[model samples]
Target chain A: MARHAQKWRDAPALNSGDEVNKASQSMEARVINPRSALLSNYEVLSLLQELEADHLARTKIAHRIKKEEEAAGTDVSVPIGGGRPSTAVETLENLRTVSFEAIKYLSADHQSTTSQTPEAVTELVKSLESYGFTKAEKLQIVNLAPQEQIELYVIVEELEDRLSQEQMVEVAEHVKKSLAAAPSLSIVAQPSHKPLIVKADENWDATDDVDEEFDDQGEGAGVEGDLDMEED
Target chain B: MFNLAILKDTVAVHPADFGTPQELAIMTELNKKYANRVLHDVGLCICVFDLTEAGEGKVRYGDGFLWYKVVFRMLVFRPFQTEVLLAKVMSSDHNGVRLSLDFFDDIYVPIHYLPVPNAFDPNERAHFWHASGDAEAKQTELLDTPVTERMWIDKGEIVRVRVEGDEFYDDEPGPVKMAEGVQVVKEVQTRAPFTIFASMAEQGLGPVSWWATAQPEDGEEQDEIMEDG
Candidate 1:
């Protein structure tokens, strides 16, 4: 058994020299602090948006430069100052693709982020200071504008133990109020078409009876009110 | 969910990038190395947040590239355990559900983690909840139930899932194999380096539409229950 163990160790020892050489040749990146700070979805979205815009601007400049060179009758196929000119562009493209994917993922079905501003988020955070929620919980509450108590419960662990039902309701109310204060472009854009369609449908149905038409108009107004509330 | 991770790396900037600003060049090099890549145990790195420290550039004996040790904060997509996140259902099977956040598509809700009393329907190629009043109801009771009566977690539906855990697998190099006298490097099926385990068993989870439509009624029921309790 000892002889077998000795051979096994010897086999690995031979390969260790090669492994060390490879390790020294390529310096591996090290993680200093894995959890330095948490970033909200809104913050990430904005950062990605900025990166996307920068990529677009860079691409435009590169395109313009290429055009100028082509017009000047220079050999445009060959890169002008060639120290792997393609690498920079390739890296930029990769960044753009990744950022675009992340932005799409972050923004999809997340209407709260559309109108979320730093000021509004800070104000909301300040209002929820009394609850003594953790930073992660607060970030989540801000990211997902929890409209109901059930949604709020999912964000904050041990919800019943931490806060009473009334407190939960109050927190939800605070979130709703803060979200409402922010001017929502989607809410504004949403109502215009729905009410118009309802009105158009009512006109088609109640053309003959005047009294029924008035009643239908009142029903349409109620529907419009419900639609508006839902948008909020 | 995202977080800032401070990472240190030695970045070698090529002589070509010397014309650009030092910070810009370093930033570009860092992004090239880290962006869209998964760091074992750390998470998927998105981009460098900011450069915190940069050591003096060193000239190697032969290489023209200037190397600088950089310490920077990187924005990474690492959802915390039990954190609530909204993701779209990519597909469902006997195993459970697969979810996608567009950029990260390896999120999975295993069969055990799905809402209790849930079963996979082979006909629909999707898993669905029985939605029966009794949590203890058997699978046989749901067999005769109409399709509309069942709450289906269909594809393309947005769901709220709580992060249960995560896994990181290292794809280490394996020994080459010989097949029919020709040495064949085995075609290892590439797996996601980082995968998230999520659960949708709690209240307000599952498809967003499920709660969206039933929210008012659900709230009223909860209020009644609270009062009774």
Candidate 2:
């Protein structure tokens, strides 16, 4: 009991230190003021401590609710954090860190050895995402073991293959009709958009002179018309 | 330009005792043994025939024996090559540069070994390769595309190389397969930038320095954390 209490004490210190360090590093990257930047580390650590406490409290509450549900001999509709109850598998995944012992718990619950691997769970989640599964649905799938992942992979693969086969037939029909009407020539030549005739330098010079004279005459007429209108 | 007596003695002496005085002291020994003999240069090539026994030492070449091969004016001596990782850089002092290698061997590289007109700055990190000189583009690809500009350890620079993955060598240990989400395209040349970690940790080739990433002093300073842990 003493050793267990000591472990709990050490956990808070190490976790807080890591959290503070990571937060400080991230803040130091963006904060410009030297004084404010130093204080940010303290603020981040305080926030982390609060979050850790809250998480502990929530876990305790969840444990109590689960125990009540088990005693009641009915499906426990205990809302896990604002939503449905999380399975044992989901709870393990939320830890982020790989727990090698997670396989045993999953095998016991699922009664299937194949559904208890991290790889299987990851694959299952990926497949669920591909199948347009909601975030919560994907999360549920992600909480599974390797066996579950394999099952999800197989199911997703079969569905995708069927959908693609149907789409391919439709695409083939569309392409066939479109090509039949596409003007078929013996050579299948594309018409050139570039001008064939190149203008001579003399013609360019003449055009430039005419444009300059026309601009000058138009300006003179505009000024004369403005003068006449003002006099009237 | 050639010393006839020295040349004759070198050829007469056995290669096994290539560095001994018997092979080198031909002129001095000749004078001491027989003062009345007169010697003349017989062109560049002189065949000295000994009256008694062909000379106590003659030349031979084998392993552990130093043999001189005359290629034009230069003499070539074969030296063994060993590959070692840059383990640690000892503090720089006026005495010279010292290095501890992963092979548990420490060596002091004198100023002469350092290439003159060093292109890298004092603060800039450098990388060192087992093979020196400019790197040949052995292979290239546009995969994983570096998120930022990349730098590497040039030859002779002290840099960090993570040992989590396989060690870098010329030969492949397993069949090379394209990684996930990567495709090999033909007729297209690839040139992708790589981070220091990718080069050393993933590719298994480097002692790449991370000085540019805002933690230059942390290279040696991390020892404190390690000690605490």
Candidate 3:
């Protein structure tokens, strides 16, 4: 982490204080600024995959060069970020099976995911917004599939008087109905929409209840987007 | 950020699967063989995007399986260094707060990496940062500022972090961390395959709530209520 801090401190943007500077080399830091949005699981895993991918690419070239140098009986070194390359056609392979396992670790059920087809969950949340369901509330409705108001209430307990039990049930029912009516809607809703293509994680672990437990960065521009709704 | 990476691999077709069309069999085998694997150098190889090249299968050796050489692209995760990212607090202990991005949950921002003058409250099982960075000259200017003064980052707080460095030395555990020749380190080998060492001690790089002026969402209220309860 100190190496990482040194790498960061080298950046011209950070030249504030000695404490911060020292801590930069000390350990990974934590913050509580509300402006920081909570990253969903998919977003995070995608990043890790990216980071790992980068590492692999660099390392492969480094190792390949090192191998050639070794064959030439010359001392060689693989640079800091990389070392190790393989067959000519054998590029670094991050087997989808490997990443998907990580996603499955988060949640195995394919049906209960946030969206049946990527955009559906976001669309459902957007459509429900007119009906007064917050994004978090709607996500809960889709993820949990609460059969009754009490189950839905378990998620939206913070609504206070904003939504009555009847409204809660109504919203939950509406989400389910939309999903049922639009199992293929995601395909049609945003025909050109391509989800995080390499996104491995399905959704916040059903047990995670991302909104309930984690401080999700509620970036409004997340998955949910406005779309032309097709009715029954 | 997610990006398309070109990946190539050879997948084998079993006798049962050989009944399908060559392309379909190769696609299924490729999907089965390549999905969800992470190559330390390339990145996490996601599902096969599309095949760029596919070779005729051969009944190689005595394996009785047909091997097809296939070239394809898969989605990959590869964030550049210093890229700002968001992570969710997973657990807090004396070591530090463990962060997760759901699928990739091995991020750790050590106590030292936290804002200076922060302390871990064992009772609360959270870390608190005493606000003191802005000078008085800066503070007085904020007398009427609409920002909610933040105190600490408790468990479950969402925070933006800078990708400082990645730590994954694919070496067997040394005696120090070895339990009878097996690595005893739980977080590294099992908790997460990769640990993203991130830093939030920088400006505009901590919890978004403190920096953003948006009114608190239900998550905030839920935490407050839970804390009180």
Candidate 4:
């Protein structure tokens, strides 16, 4: 249970000095980098956000065109088939939504935060690297702020045997101490609304003015530009 | 959460265990073969409960071992759709929240299923639900002090989740290598044997604290009726 190796016979004898050393060595050797295990959380999210916003924006245009066509216009929407988004799109959107809800918080979101105190978490993450923790693992540790050894173990249980029980306990104690010393968690401001147009590329905005009465004018709901929102 | 399932398997008995009782030898061999393993049809095998049959051991041709057929009932944990469970929040992030039972830990709840009008606190690294009077919760809970409306699930908090579905992925092959002049297999796929896709998208679901204190939602004695680990 403490290690990932499933085959009992392959394992070094359960409780021996050599077995302990082999356990830790085998753990690191077998495990993959945490980054590879990352999900399509952020990419799929931003993609669906862009896709839905795109679909909605396009639908609004098609509706307006149809209304104008009724007066004295053409059938531009014919080639595009239906006014509604494609079934594939709808199905994917549903699956993505359901999957997103279920798989959320399991992985980190790609959006880099322009938090005022980024250095605190960054420093802690960097310090954790020396202890054989991956970047994702470190991020998780910083995020959790685990208060007890048992709680900390839950996060690293996949590789629990890699570090001695004493070492793990020490690390857990260190995490608790660091969290206690750090300032209280600050309030997170609501993310800015960027337009859906630039979602894929540079300077994408996610404005919430995705109403039907959208004006095809200067810019759609250009309230405040996301100054910090930029490409990595 | 718990169910009995029958398993049929053949066990190899070595001469080293000849001194031990045949039943004991077979039991040890059977446990070693199946414990902590996931079967596609049976979900996950917790332990061998009771043996229905332990066939007589037959000597092998060349190898100094006996092959025995064992029929046994095993305790399994295979969550069904809509099975409400009590789990602890393993961690929370912008994408959603992760909950874990002691035996299994890959349960997830996405943002869409979260309480109405919740936002991810990037700095805090946890998602929060802002129950509001207005349907469109324009104000951020962080800025305002809607104490009762603002419900947050921190790490390690006990949460109630319903099993939406479960997924099984065949263990991918591993790299082949030579060890001690013999071929060795390096298979370390951390893919969870049985990943349970669950949702906390209901009134009785979310953190147990809310439903535990407030009147039970949908009027179904949810608290007492929850069949969980």
Candidate 5:
């Protein structure tokens, strides 16, 4: 009779153990399989939010870089061929400035027999153009002296004998004087163009008055002419 | 075909052991062309040698003395030709020089390149050309003459050779091959280190120095020594 009572107690314990096992298996199954659509939606939403936040951060970084560049006034756009623009006004200015500097150093003292003042040279250029001289001949005349300019004019007019005898003699004398002057100026202005015009100002006379004082002070020592030219 | 080194009929070699007659001839010609030549400008001749050997003691990667040799066969011979022009002496001294060329170029020969004349005659045109700047020249013509030349030059003197195989002293050498219709002129002016330095100190551009008539202390010392003697 006691044994039968013990068996009854054991049977209830066994039944409880089976029930616990069943509950555990149900929990495992729920975890392994997605039973509800709500959890999936929550996970997907979380992932999308993370990606959006990363994208926003990257965009903010790019915007900040752009803003900083704008503030500094830097043109960061790459050219088609990765070359600096050739049409820059600064480059043209630099070239003109250099040319002007070269012209400035040219001096009358440095002039050779072939050298002429800037004004004389310009006049010769105009004359040569009017006479329809060859480009090379015109260029050569422009680089010549006042005397040479006269000679070239006569020679071009003569066309190797077209000019009158008087013109020929006059031109020849001018050429001789120019040739004689060549040695003096050539020695001083070696490798330099002659009759260098440093400054071109219509109001140069006003400043030239002051320049005489400057010359007396030896400030304009190597200048072409002093105040005496003004007295003339 | 020629033997690279002629033997005195002293040795006998099997036909298989000796190099071919053509090979020997090639070696002989190469040796004759390159034997005494020195490595001039490695930087300018980079196309001939490996780029890695520049500035290093090694001339070429393959053989000895290969880098020192200039292949003269590849060069063209343009004869010495120039038009001589008469020019008047403006002003010249040991320090600076200015002369006109065809009234076109007023070439300024500064102190360093002023060709000093050892001896000259005032009446002689060549002598005048040589000694115009020298104070010793009592008289000089006052005129401009033009000169032209196509040839090798050394120390401002025209050399007899039509083609210069090596321009070792030039700061910049001419083109390797002067193509037809293309003429690129190269000029090099050498100045004393002190002069260059002084010019730089005074102005950005190289201008002639201001003339000072008084002699320096060194000149005074020489004068005193002369007096004592």
Candidate 6:
């Protein structure tokens, strides 16, 4: 109970501070450097999860306190100032909403974040060091976990010129291994978009050889797809 | 997708908050001011990362609040140009497709940025790509295929897109005026402060299901052999 009281008291003096800053024109906030560092999706996801857990705990404690006050016959419904909630309460609510939305977005099925861990991600980075990929390219590779050479081509520019076919295959294998080693957590319900099943003989022409190569590396993903089909 | 931005702000701490630690009080004040808000060009601010420096507090003549100049780092949601990202389709129209990251929903993939030979189906209210039987020729030409064969980018489907650009609008509130005898309330136009432009024209960048691994003929043959055995 004492801890819960401290949480509300921790709300800053935003109302008065804003008023002061508005009155003094010279005190306007400014950006020093817009891009000081880059943060990966995993970093942001873990941080938000921590913040959300804390917010939920505090909310539950606050609700219990309100119920107790009501049982004691104290009127707890009165607003602190006339009929308006305090700015502190409003700020906390804003934080809760923003964090919740961000978490949902990051945990979407398209993102491979749920199966990623700090150790696996770090190891993947170390293994990718030899490829000499740009920072942005490396980040995207880690974020997407592309299983096929074509998918890697999308993230890494000029794939044909930069790396040979064998090297590309090796990179995809590394990503697959890392992802497999990590424990998977289903954060969001997977969208029930049925797999587009293409008959093997329907389009078996010169393109079949190329697709066979893609299928070879993505065998792990193919097995998973088969499992989903079986369940259905 | 997230960048750390360093910003400087003058924080005013009231006497009522003096009981708390100095840094905690200042951090609370900063978060209240910046969290979940969009800066003009920096992108959407998420939350404060850490404080770098805080100058000595100064007291004003009239107000009892102490003001301090603080420099801090904050997390900002700003994807780089040409960066590939995954987003869910929010809606579709003649204009194009609107995407959402859930928190930030002002993403638009213009019609031209979509794959070529695409047509908007008013009846279904979604766009369909006229894919050809030949995988190589699908992007260049439209084949006269049946409706069931075409690829439809329906609502709620996840798609991979490349970030093309971003726009920021500085919309300041206009001054209020009294007209004639009645006080006319001016209708304010609400626009997103920041919007991202994305594209899905490239290969390996479309619906996730489209790129799902194709089962090899050899694997299927192996299954048939096992059944016979």
Q: Model 2, B1-229: lDDT tens per residue?
A: 1111222121222232232333222322322322221121111111111111123432332233332221111000001012112234443333334443321222443333332211222333332222222332221211122312223233344433222212212222344446686754434343211101111322222222332233423534333322332
lDDT: worst 10-residue window of model 1 chain B: B220-229
| Model 5 per-residue lDDT at A158 | 39
lDDT of 1 by residue, A1-232 (tens): 9999999999978887776676466477888899999988877877776554344433333444445556778634445766455312334545656787998877775547876766677888998999989988998998888887778878998989999888898898888877777675222222231132223333331123333434433323323233222111
Give the B-chain TM-score of model 4.
Answer: 0.79
Q: By TM-score, how accurate is candidate 3?
A: 0.45
**Cα-based lDDT at residue A123, candidate 1:** 87
The sequence of per-residue lDDT tens digits that candidate 3 reaches over residues B78-180 is: 4435555555678888777788765566778886787655556665677655464353323234333322343557666667666677755455544556678
For model 3, report the TM-score of its A chain: 0.40
The window of 10 residues in a row where model 2 chain A has the poorest summed lDDT is: A31-40
Tell me which of candidates 1 and 4 scores higher on TM-score.
Answer: 1
DockQ value of candidate 6: 0.28
lDDT of 1 at A61: 35
Better of 1 and 3 by DockQ: 1
What local lDDT does model 1 show for residue A36? 92
Question: Tens digits of per-residue lDDT for model 5 on A133-171?
Answer: 554444333333324223244224334455566654654
Q: What is the C-alpha lDDT profile of model 3 across A130-210, one tens digit per residue?
A: 657654445445554444443444445355477766666667676676556544322222322223321212232222332
Across B151-213, the per-residue lDDT of candidate 5 in tens digits comes to 001122211111112133434454554558676554557521111101111111111110111
Off by over 4 Å in 4: A1-232, B133-148, B174-190, B215-229
lDDT by residue (A81-175, candidate 6, tens digit) is: 45421111213545556777888888876688878877788999899999989999989988888887768878999989989888898899899
Ranking by lDDT: 1, 6, 4, 3, 2, 5
DockQ of each: 0.31, 0.01, 0.06, 0.02, 0.01, 0.28
Q: Per-residue lDDT tens digits of candidate 1, residues B63-138?
A: 8888888899899999999899999889998899999998899999998887777878888878877665457766
Better of 1 and 3 by lDDT: 1
RMSD after CA superposition, every candidate: 16.6, 43.9, 22.2, 25.7, 35.0, 17.2
DockQ (0 to 1) for model 1: 0.31
* lDDT by residue (tens digit), candidate 4, B59-164: 7445778877777665455655655556778988877898876456778887777766777776656766655434466436453644444466677777766677
